[model samples]
Target chain A: MRGNRIRGHGLAGYIVLSVFAVPTLFPIYVMLNMAGKDLFQYTLRPLLPTFPYHFENYLYAWQFLARSFFNNLVIIGVSTTIVLLLASMTAYALARHSFPGKRFVFYAILCVLAIPATVIMVPQFMLVVQLGVVNTLFAVMLPYAAHQSLVIIVLYTSFSQLNESMFEAARIDGAGHLRIFTTIVIPLSKPILAAMAIFEVWWLWNDYAWPSLVLSSARLRTVALQLVTFVDGMAIPQPGQEMAANVIAALPIVLLFLFSMKTFISGITSGAVKL
Target chain B: MMDKPQVLAGHRSARRMRDVRIYLLMLPSLVLISLFFYYPAVSGFIYSFTRVTTRGAVWAGLANYQRLLADTRLIASFGNLAQIVVFNVIVVATMPLMAAVLMFRMRNPRAQYAFRLMYVFPMVVPMVVMIIIWRWIYSLDGGLNILLSLVGLESITRAWLGDRQLVLYAIMFVNFPWMGGLNFLIYLSGLQSISEELFDAAIVDGVGPVSRFFLIELPLIRDQIRLLVLLTVIFWLQRFELPLILTDGGPGWASMVPGLRMYHSISRDFNIGYGSAIGTVLFILVFGMTMLQMRLGRRRAAADNR
Candidate 1:
């Protein structure tokens, strides 16, 4: 009787999960299938394979998008590194030290979180233009780095929950503030930091609107911006090629999620609850 | 006596030096926020009060706000956003709550893990890529149409995004998959935190599963629900990528929301002041909703504590 009950539950779970999973993943599968087919085959049947496989379309998309994969890497790499360093240091000070106006500063950061990026995009663009950094990687990286103080505030809140005695002990061992932060506070807060890093990486990698406004040069276009090329002049690229580009664009994040699913889930939940 | 006074002066200097170092540590983030965040936000507000031309901004005092009030297109854009916000509240609130309850009922460990992971997969993919993939699915002879045909519903398959009436709702449906992830996880966490002893007590009172959910679980998860609703409203108002890529506010601006409308006014028309006014309205709407949500969340949290 118990065995039967267990089997029934398992079956129900599988059915429910698959129903949800198919919609989530179906687009990627369709894209892959479409990208592999030629234009003639794609438009003729619309469903079902007429060809084995071909990758020539990816090359065309790569050139059309213009420095896409490389540009995206530079943007992500530079922005993520800057965000991590600045957020960590700021978070360390806020979490560990007590200063006048600290509460005011923290609340200010929280306020910015509620203001959508769209609200600031126009003025931010004008600011970037006046600085003569338009169409450059710096325009993308600077705003992203500046906008990341919220990550620091969130991290600091979690880090503050740690015992202060640990810091005192480090100080007793002749460690200075910088030494204590790097050796003690940072290592102990790894879980929260990891969570913040992955979350921000995903955010920066997939961001579209800011990049669209600040970056118009073909050579500096990020992957998300490059995906826009598929609909050039309102002519949709072959379904297969469009799908292929999406698959490539989505691949890194998917892999990251699969590997760190636990942290990603926990991090988001923790952050939300704290807020 | 001279040596002791000198030592006391040295201690005072060291303390001042430490305080300065702390301020230096905070300097970068403070400056960055002032320059990049608060500066633009304040200037954005100021620009809304002017007339921006090819040369520069000229004082237009209330003209931009007047234009926003009189503009039919902007009004329609807000109406469209209201529809999305309504739909988002329903989808984001109810669907995930149901999924979370079902997830709680399942006893098998591996099944639970798999279900949780599957739900969150959509959250990992960038919104841009997700929209692109959906565009393919919504193509006339694409996956969705093919599926409709296979199910003997060929007449139902129109260009999902092409029809003026159906375009907004179709775009909403594309965002539906994301509903499963964050909301489900939050609800799950809330459920797990409820004490098992309370469930046992309810069972002893002869309460069934449905009543237990209503009498026990609903009250417990009220805070999470309120937060989720607030988040839904903000996200719906701010949503730009999906509509931008999918419909591009097509079929005579039928699907245009405030975000897209603001983008269009600036990028297409270069009417910066007008665009800033629209943006200001959007900011106010979002800010008001957030404040309302925070107030409700706080009240519920207080009540729950009591």
Candidate 2:
């Protein structure tokens, strides 16, 4: 009977979903369509993909695309690795260990979570200047890793929930803190680690606000920064070339999300606790 | 375990070594936070009081704040941001709830998965791309007014981003079918976490779907709604990307948000001290709100306890 009642709404649900989903998807569809169309024609026939399809738009945009994309990948990749290591290790200690003033340490990290990037980014820029890393990837990665306090809290909750007996048995076997962290806790917490990595990567990849400030040099700019330069700065980039650049910028993360939808989605639902 | 002095001493040393190792392992994150997070934050506040230049920062007292108070652009930007927060909160809070209700009602697992995939797909698309696409769509001859005119609403068509009044709404409404990219999935997860037995019992008692939803699912998912609302407010407050990309704070600053104002203060205006002042204000706003939120969380926990 429960099943039958649920089945009753199936048809109506599809109609309703189509109503919302189609328009929800329309802007993206138009984007993809624009990317593949002629620069001159898309303005006139903005709704449909034009021909002969300017597949060459992508080809033309490719030269200006590589360097920024590479910079984004490098910065995001390095930062994510550092975030995972630091968040996991710190969270593990906060969870399993009984060190002096542990609760204070944990809450201190959590307090930092309340401070938004906007507040710190200005001085962060000043700090970058003071450190002489103003235009380097290190400048981006340093602030990037430091802001993973929320991730630490998320992983802390995950780590703290592990059965206490498991750690006890390891300790009874004369396993040290480092070994147990490596052998038992880390292996056991791969899912959270993966989730943390995915969560960090998604944000770090698309991050614009900070990187735009820090990486002012053309060669050091991430794809996000390059996208801004493409649109806002230059009149040279056409509708076609710009759309191609936008599509190119968006493709990797879109592909990443598609391939790991479950992991990515789960990671997000849990980690949406982030500011 | 303490039968002999030798055994006790060995155990004490081992435990001390473990504690020392634990602290050592925790050092990297501490160092990074101290340098990048706390130091910058403290300095950011201090810098707000000093005029930063290439040569060195000099004391500027309340001059930056005084200037900010007089700046018409800053005042107008705050007004715009307030409007954005209201509309953004409504749209983000409700759209996903509606979608989640539909998703929870859908019987077919395959269809549910498909819809979830479709809704969440945009979240992965870089935000810059989304802003760029909208920039085109809202262009004078771009798709929006073109589509609007073709639908016979020709009288309403105008330059979407060029008109200061219209541009704010243009930024807010561009993702029109804002089934919302990420929060949709978050809401779905929240709805799915509800125990089926509650629904079964409500049905047995002859409650209608609407009653059951309001009386049960709505209250149950308060945490998710609150979580989403909190994150949306905080995230949007600091958000500059859309304004920076979509309108560059507009033909006249219609969409100039505090975040963008902060960016411009440092980058465009070349007043690091003033930017820091802006950042400090933003920080205080968020910090005050989050503290209030934590107080509410504690109150809720106490209620649950009782």
TM-score of each: 0.91, 0.93
Query: Which candidate comes out best when scored by TM-score?
Result: 2
Q: Write the per-residue lDDT of candidate 1 for residues A194-223, one digit (tens) a residue.
A: 887777777788789888877878778888
Docking class of 2: medium
Clashing residue pairs in candidate 1, if any?
A34-A240, A35-A240
The digit string of per-residue lDDT tens for model 2 on A1-275 reads 12224324557668887788887787678777887777578656868767787888898777778998789778888888888888888998888877787988888898887777766788888888889988899989888878778888988889989998887777768666678889988999898888778888878877887888878789998888887787777765577777888888888878778788778877866666555
- Which tens-of-lDDT digit does each residue in B1-306 have in candidate 1? 001122465766756666678778878887887788888888889999998877888999999999888989779878888888898888877878877776776777677777777677677777798788788788787788999999999989989899989998887788545446678888888888887877767766876666877998898888788888888787778768778888888767888888888887766887888888888888888778777876786687698799
Instruction: Give the Å shift of residue B129 in candidate 2.
Output: 0.9
Task: Give residue B257's lDDT in candidate 2 (0 to 100).
Answer: 89
> Which residue ranges in model 1 land beyond 4 Å of their true spot?
A1-20, A49-66, A233-236, A270-275, B1-9, B176-179, B296-306
**Model 2 residue B227 lDDT score:** 68
Q: In lDDT terms, how accurate is model 1?
A: 0.76
Which residue pairs collide, candidate 2? none
